[model samples]
Target: MVLAAAGCSENAMYDLDGGAMDAAVVEARSLEIVGDPTVSLAGGDTADLTVQLRDPSGAPLAGETVRFALDGRAHDSTLETVTATTDAMGLAHSALQAGTVVAAFRVRASADDAASVSFDVAVGDAGFGSMQVTPEYVGERETLPRVVVGLFADADCEDDFVRRDPGDRLQVLSEDDELVRFLGLPAGVSFAVAVRAEGEGGTVLAWGCEDRIAVEALETTDVDVTFDDEPLVVDGSYQTTSVFPTTTGEDVATALEGARDALLPASDATLILDAAEATLSGAEATELRAARASGFDATYQTALESLGPAAAHEALIDRLRTELTSLTVVGRLRATEGELDFSVLRLGMGAGELEVALTELTIETSLDATLDSEELRVSELLIDLSASELVRALATREAFDRLLDGPSAWLASAASCAALPPPEEPIGCDAVCLQAACRTVLADYWTAALTVIEALDQERSTLELDGSANVADLAGDLQVDTLEGSLAGEWTGPSATSPEALEGTFSGERITPPR
Candidate 1:
């Protein structure tokens, strides 16, 4: 009898050990669930989970694999298992899952150190479900990295709850998979938030940007979630979404102006020209003019190339240069909403200013657009100036009529050839006649200019004359000691033309009154 009892006892003890190993230590992430947890999951829908494994003492246990099963026959499979390993304290977790049925979940985990632990499995008969919301905070000139929010349900809300993300990899989950409440984002961005609600067993309701949270530098806005059944449904659901702004600021005017001044001749070149042109004599004056023109051309290109880092003055110079060539103006911008206005000149194609504007310049895009908005891509940059006005302004009014008369036409003609190539092609070389032609053209231009000048309505705008006819006459009779070598004159538009018009009076080089 003793021998039989011993054998029986040993067998019972072995069975007991096996039973302990198969027992499950199961847990949910948090108590006092915040929202309706029951949800209908479609075939591919994913739900977040927060699970825990522990011993009876509430101490976490380790190395646990939990198997999940659904009761409904329509489930892809009634048996689906997930393996989890506990931390040093024996605490382990399983993320939430989206399943076909709400009331069909059963979970169990191994609870022992010897390949398994003694434990128990716990599951809700109503099943796991949850709803959530998050807010995104953004800034100007800065990227909006991430956003989060929380949800709250009425006292009548059910306790059946699951998290939105299991590992919180998709979103950072603190105590639960769902963070329906929001807090703490820096002042650099603007934000809007929203929530997702798991409706019934087979349905999910989503609320887009239901919450607009503008997190400022020093404060956090309120995050509240409330919902109603617009259709007079049996249950109520709620959710919210988040949006943000990426940039902000005040000094756009200064920024744009700084961008402009960079388009000119170097400050150093301006200084050099000033110093060099100061003491020039008659002969030196001619030399200075040639040198100045060459210097300007070379320095202008260099300055234009260096525009990316120029000051305001340089920008002004660049704008002036725009009047010197051909270009297009694409669009304009206002840095300060009401404080400033500007137009951007788009340089046309090829070796001139257009190519220059294409060079990279480091300007903050948000100076005009939202920080999150696209960069203010500029294919061309230039200063706006009126070439036509410059043309009109440079004409000499008072002296135009005189140069077109008698021998003066001939001398002026020669001077014109000396200054610029004739605009059109012609035959028969006659120096005297050519000189007269220059005088005539110059007269026409000046008169046209005078017409423009009257329109300007400016007081003292002036121009210089290259006076004319015979070389000898220019060198002698017209060369009165009292007369300045340079003939400079100023004029405005003629209300009427001179009563005395000129006719050909002297051979080739002279301007004569027309009879």
Candidate 2:
């Protein structure tokens, strides 16, 4: 008694003897939920879960039966799944209806020869809540490049939120943004919210956390996070008296200061020595020319002009040798902003004496700063010569005057002498010959003096420090590190140069109140 099968599909064909026959055998190779793996639902709500069945080549395998099942018995009582058949597009649809109680469950889909996928369905009492977070930066409100707002299960946020895994619901806000929203968070339960503010380099600039924040099932929770700069421990008085040049590496401040310190001494010494040489050379040369013109030797006049000037240069050099280079910054960072009393022990020349004085300085602008739990960050530190300018204005004129004053007085005295004697005899003096020699000596003296003034001016404004530094506490003081920048600018004395790399480290201790 043989039966015949009719209307067989492409996946299965019937044999002539009425037995089922394998025609085009297609097995499910992969299965995945059509949409998001996680879904939120209120009590007694239903959501459609769709799964796609695919072959080895990812072509849809139609007419396949996909069984929708729950993983454990815990979810067996709260939620249930239904079986469905794959359509022509290899998609199977199933319905998930939550029970009266609010609970969470995972739905699994299985097909023959295909890996199963899961859907995390969270059921809340009534509905879900949306969290809107607003962040306010208290100091130097620069735009934060990255803001991560995390919503964690109240238990996981008990400890350090930064060390935990990315929370149950995490969302990143756009750069320089002030607000972020997290939608569809499970409601009727306490949650801990943690926010992290980051710079462009992804360094964590600020952190804020709030716990036991409750969200009504249907209401939007408005939360505020304050990233106050006051937490950085930089508000008190700090005095950085030690000028430790930690590295000769690529740092603008170090290179500029170092180059000035190194060059000033050599330059001053060279200037004094050159002044003597110029006076001697100018006097003798002028005497020679005057003697030939006047038909007699003018050696006595030359000796008078060049004598006793060694005492002045010797005193100047001695004063410069005892000078010390030091940096002292005394100030307070009140509410992350304040002015600093800045001073640097610098070498200067004034009033016929070498000046080793404390140069009062000021920054070019207010500090562009941000303070966090770890450190205070400054965008750049530019040391400007407020004191140097005053000295340059006052001492430049006076020093140059004194430089020519002594020489000019000597020249004038020699010129005005009317003692009667011919250039042929050394009994008295030839006033005309003496005046000519004095003129030549004064010309060379003024040239050397001007060179010294220009050299001092060139080094005056060279302390431009570029780059950023992290300032933190070290044994109750401020420790600064990681400074890097370049030193290059037009020399005020007429020279062009390229930037040289510089680096260094310095620390300061609190010397005043609030220590």
- Candidate maximizing lDDT: 2
TM-score of candidate 2 versus the correct structure, residues matched by position: 0.33
lDDT of 1 by residue, 232-320 (tens): 11111111111111010011123323443332224433432343344345765565456556555354325334321122233323333
Task: Report RMSD for candidate 1.
Answer: 28.8
Q: How accurate locally is residue 199 in candidate 2, as Cα lDDT from 0 to 100? A: 46
Tens-place lDDT per residue, model 2, 1-515, is: 00111223444432111123333333337676788766787666788889898887998989999987654221322434468899999999888887654443456677777655656556676567677987666644344444566566433345764334334454555443567765666677776776665543344555667778777776899988666432444444444322322111112223333444332333322222233334444555555445446633233434334332232233223322322122222223333244333344332322232222322233332444454435445554454433234233233334344453433343223333223123444322244544443344434433443344344444444444433334543332222221222222221222314322224333444444333
- Worst ten-residue run, lDDT, model 2? 244-253
Candidate 2 residue 437 C-alpha distance from true site, Å: 25
Tell me the lDDT of candidate 2.
0.46
